[model samples]
Target: MQFIDTHAHLDVEEFAEDLPEVIIRAKEAGVAKIFLPAVDLPSVSTVLQVCRDYPNYTFPMIGLQPEEVKGDYQEVLKKMKKILDASFAQSSPFIAIGEVGLDFYWSREFEQEQLIVFEEMVKWAVEYQLPLMIHCRKAQNELLHILKKYKHDLVGGVFHCFTGNQNEAAEYLKFDNFVLGIGGVLTFKSSHLREDLPACVPLERIVLETDSPYMAPTPHRGKRNESAFVANVLRQLAASYQVSEEIVASITNQNVARIFGISV
Candidate 1:
């Protein structure tokens, strides 16, 4: 059974010393593809290089993470868009605009800035016909509010690291095209995700992700997350839905392909 880490920071420095080993281990664990979403301008080149090195096994997306939003965001977004255009002209375009959205968990210091940048990035998705890999923390209401304006324009995307309740999950499901990205949090003993997720979302509207170098599943909790460990999250989801791991992998892989338009 093959799996896809719909979202992972595979190009970050955390894997710098032994990225090849990580890729090998991921393949051994049945992870067929890993999507690298950029957090800032610096990450553009890093994600590009890693994706170029691995070719189809790894892919890239450019966007300014909400938490990373601050002064000079305009300049950063401009440069990122330029790189995206040039890269697309030279080769296949990026799959999405993501790992981007609103985060109010830490502080509201940059809330306005985050909203502006988030909307701009969403516009890029609409303009380029790319999907979005969204991240939200304590701000789903705001995120959904903005997306409502693009009811007809936005193609689709994954609501990465979704930790919301049934009602919230229902709201996203109403979008018809978007899916909830489930990851390591579901494996946490204290998390209500496992129980809540199974009953809240249908298998068709869900996808798998590691959000690697972070959100490592149980057993590897509190450690650096890697793509291979995504299998743990897959196992957790399978158990939650009372289905086999292979079944979970197959459906999520199909869902990932539908969202990104890339078959695995």
Candidate 2:
């Protein structure tokens, strides 16, 4: 069965020593496409370089992660804008504007700044007519509020590592503008997702992701994740919905392609 990892940090330092091996393992595991999400200015070059090196496998998404938003965020924004502007000017293969959203889990001090940056990025996505990859933590309500306001403006996107309740899932469905990114969290025995997700979001509206170098699935839990481990997520999802793994893989792969305009 073919699979797509809609969000991963393969360019992060964790994979620096053996990225080639990681890619080989992913291919063996049937992960046909891997989307790389930019976390900040410093990592953009590395992200793009990885995509360039593995064009047949890796796709790129450009955005500023919320946790990376700092006091000098304006400078970071300028850098991101510059990179994006250059990509458009050069017709670079950036598939979406993403891994962008609010995160109050870390520090609330930059809450206002993060919101401003998020709104700007949303505006950019609208202008480019590209989907977004959102990251939310302890700010789903606030993220939903902003998403509602710009729902009409956005082309579409995904809520990476979605952990919201059923009502929250319903809100995302209302826009038909996004999909819930299911990852290792769903495979956890104690995860609320295992109980809440299948009843809430339909399988067609879900996409698979590993969020690699993090959130490794159960049995491999606590280890650094990679796209190869997406099979575990697929297995758990299929079991939850009482379907074959191939069916789950095909549906989620289609969902990722439809949302991000990538192929597996």
TM-score per candidate, chains pooled: 0.97, 0.97
Instruction: Give the runs in model 2 whose Cα sits over 4 Å from its true position.
Output: none
Q: For residues 89-203, what per-residue lDDT tens digits would candidate 1 score against the true structure? A: 8865588897799999989999999999999999989988889999999998999999999968888999999888999999988786899999899999999988888887888
At residue 123, candidate 1 shows an lDDT of 92
C-alpha RMSD between model 1 and the true structure: 1.1
The TM-score that candidate 2 achieves is 0.97
What C-alpha lDDT values do all the predictions have?
A: 0.90, 0.89
The residue-by-residue lDDT of candidate 2 on 1-264, one tens digit each, is 799988899998899999999999999999999999998987888889999999868988888999988899999999889889988999878899987999999679999999999999999999899999999999978887787888887888898898889998888788775888999999988888887888988898999999999999998999999999999999999999989999998898888778777767
RMSD of each: 1.1, 1.0
Off by over 4 Å in 1: none
